[model samples]
Each structure stands twice: as C-alpha cells, then as structure tokens.
Target: MRELTFENVTVRFGSRRRGTVAVDDVSLRVPAGQVVGLVGESGSGKSTLARAAVGLAPLASGRISPAPHERHVQMVFQDPYSALDPRMSVGESIAEAGRRAVDVAGLLELVGLPGDRAGDRPHLLSGGQRQRVALARALAGDPEVIIADEITSALDVSIQGAVLNVVRELQRRMNLTMLFISHNLAVVRYVSDIVAVMKDGRIVEYGPVDEVLGDPRHEYTRELLAAVPRPAH
Candidate 1:
C-alpha cells in the first residue's frame, strides 16, 4: 500500500482574482493501508479535497506527493448510476478502467456481486449493487489508494449498511489505503481509523477516531458529534 499526502494544498475555481477557494491550504495524510475518514457538512471542502487528490480539481498552489495519477489513486464517486455508462455492461465498465488481462469476474465477486452479473447493464442493478460495481471498477485499476467521496450518501439507509460492509471487508482483505469521505459521523466512526473534521475550507481537528470523536478539542468537531442522533434507552 502507498501513502497519500497533501501539503498545504489549495484549489481554486474561476479567475485568480475573482475565483473562490474550494480547498484552502489544507494538509493531511492517509497512511498506507489505513482508512482516513474525512467528515464535514455540505460545501465544507471535503469533496473538493477528494477531487483535487484525483486530479479532477486543479490546484492553485502547493503540492500532492506521488502526484495525481490514475494508476495509483482511484476514486469511487457517490453516484454510481451517473458514474457508469448506461449502455455499457458491468463487465465492460470494469474492463475499461482496468489494465490489460483484468479479472472482471473475480473483481465482481470481490465486491460481493455474482461473477455472472458482468453482462448486466448499470440500469438493471439496484443503487447498492451499482455502487458495488463502481467499487469493483476501482479495484480493477489495482490502485493502492482509493478516494471514496460520500459513496453511501446516495443509497437508501437499509442498503447503506450492506455497501459499507463490502467496503470494510475489501479494505481488510486488500489492505487498501482509503480516504472515506462522509457527512455521517456514525459511518465514519465505524470505518475509519483516523478522523479529520473539516469546517469551511480547512481541517480543524484530526486524530485517532476514538480520541477525536470521544473527546473533541475543536468546537466544530464537538458540534458535529453532538449533532448525531442517539437512540433512546
């Protein structure tokens, strides 16, 4: 597994003079073979950072180590339906992103999907299954690091757990280094070893998931934790 690093990275949009900064001088790391969860509310720059990591969003300044190359870093986008082509069968999509001599069936089975479902089109699968296909496609690239941007936010609550289970299992089985971005604290807490809380366009607090969530030092982190709904006794 390879580690991902961001050094004072900044991403801007539009003209330099008038453009807004989507990610502002942010620095973080996803250690090799570890899951780093990035949590923040809407427009907090979490997704922008993920995009910048994958070379989708251009950076105005600073640098990202190992560079933004598709072979090393792959992203599993939130909306699998839109991410995959409607005309292409599941096998074709995975093969397209993968290197030569790819195991399309094995990749499908790895994500808990049947090997025979390769011929099925994206529209025929449920939201959760499409997301699994997306995961398989990402794995086909043989990437050391994966940037999952709110991957489960688009799915139904009942199906969310199943997809997340696949992710957790894959991470353990493959020792995949990941940047799991989500707005849900519970989900982050469940999957992440380290947690980073972002507010506005910067990370305000970051540490081990237990420490950061259990005893938050930053006000924003505390507020986010407090916002999680608790079950009645």
Candidate 2:
C-alpha cells in the first residue's frame, strides 16, 4: 500500500489572466490503506485534483507524490463506456494495464465478476458490470492509489450500492489507498473514512466522515448536506 500526497497544489486552465483556477492551493494527504472522499458540486475543482493525482491534468504549482511501488496511479472514470474500448474483450481491456502476469479470470473475480465474463465485450454487459470491469482494469497494474471519479453517478441506485460495496470490500481486503470523488455527500459518507468538502476550488471543510458531515462548520458544507434527499421514515 502507498500513500498519495498533494502539497500546496494549484491548477489553472487557459492563460493566467484569462484562465480559470480549477484547484487553488490545495493540500491533502491520502494515507496508505484508507479511502479519502473529495466532495463538491460541479466546477468545485474536486475532479481537477483527482486528475492531478492521476497525472491527467497539469498542475500550475505544488506537487503530487504517488506510492513507491506504483509506476503510476490509476483512475476509474465516470463513464466506463468511454473509458473502455468497445471492440476489446473485458479481459483484453484489463490486460492493457500491462499486468499480463495476472490472469484474466483472476482480474474478473477481483471486481466481483465471474471469471467467464472476461471474454465479453463492454457493450454486452450492463452499466454496473462495465464499471466493475473498469475497476478490474484499474487494479491490473497493482497501483498504490486508485482515483475513482464520480464512478457511480451514471448507475441506478441499486447498482450504485452494489458497486460501492465492491469498492469498500476491495479497499479493506487489498489495503488499497483510494481517492473517491463525488458530489453526493451521502455516498461519500457511506464509503469514506475521511471527507473533504470543496467550494470555489478550495477545501472548506475536512475531517472524519461523521465529524465533517454531521457537524459541518462551513456554510457551503451545511448547504450541501441539506440538499441531499432524505428518506422519510
């Protein structure tokens, strides 16, 4: 397991004068073997931070350090369909992560899919199954840290719960360090050990899931919590 660290990170888009600041002076630490949830509304810069962690976005300043054994951090994106190749078999897609030594069957089983499903293509599977395959592919490289960016947003509630369960179990059993990015506070509370609430490109509140979500000090955090739909008992 490896820890991911972001020290005084900043990311800007376009020109310095005409550009937008996606992430502003952000400092975060995702310790090894723990899940850190980054939550915010659209354009709040949580996704940019996740992208920076995975080396997908250029940081205007600061540093991102991946775990020692990981060649690179892997990301499980929001749209598995777009992330995966339609022509490739699920097994082949997983093997693309360059872990040929890990058998396809093992990879499938690791993500809660049957071993025999490896030969199936992305189009042949349900959205949840495709996302699981995406997870398997992300795991193929044995990454020290996995960045999951709004992975459950596209799935139905039932499927989302199942997927979250798979992810939670995997994190525990594999001791995988993870950064789970989402706009939903409820989902973040369900899966995260620590939660960071973002607003206007900066973290407004961060702490243990219960403490931050239960007793939000920031006004933005309070508004976010109040926005979540609650079930009537």
- Top candidate (lDDT): 1
Residue-by-residue lDDT tens digits, candidate 1, 1-233: 99999999999999989999888999999999999999999999999999888888999998986588646999999997799999999999999998777899999999999999999999899999999999999999889899999999999999999999999999999999999999999999999999999998999999999999999999999899889999999
Candidate 1 global TM-score: 0.98
Task: Compute the lDDT for candidate 1.
Answer: 0.94
Model 2 residue runs over 4 Å out of place are 67-70
Error of 1 at 140 (Å): 0.4
RMSD of 1: 0.9
Scored by CA lDDT, what does every candidate get? Answer: 0.94, 0.90
lDDT tens readout by residue for model 2, 108-200 = 898899999988888999999999999999899878889999999999888999999999999999999999999998889889999998899
- Name the TM-score of candidate 2: 0.96
Q: How many residue pairs clash in each candidate?
A: 0, 0
Clash pairs detected, candidate 2 = none
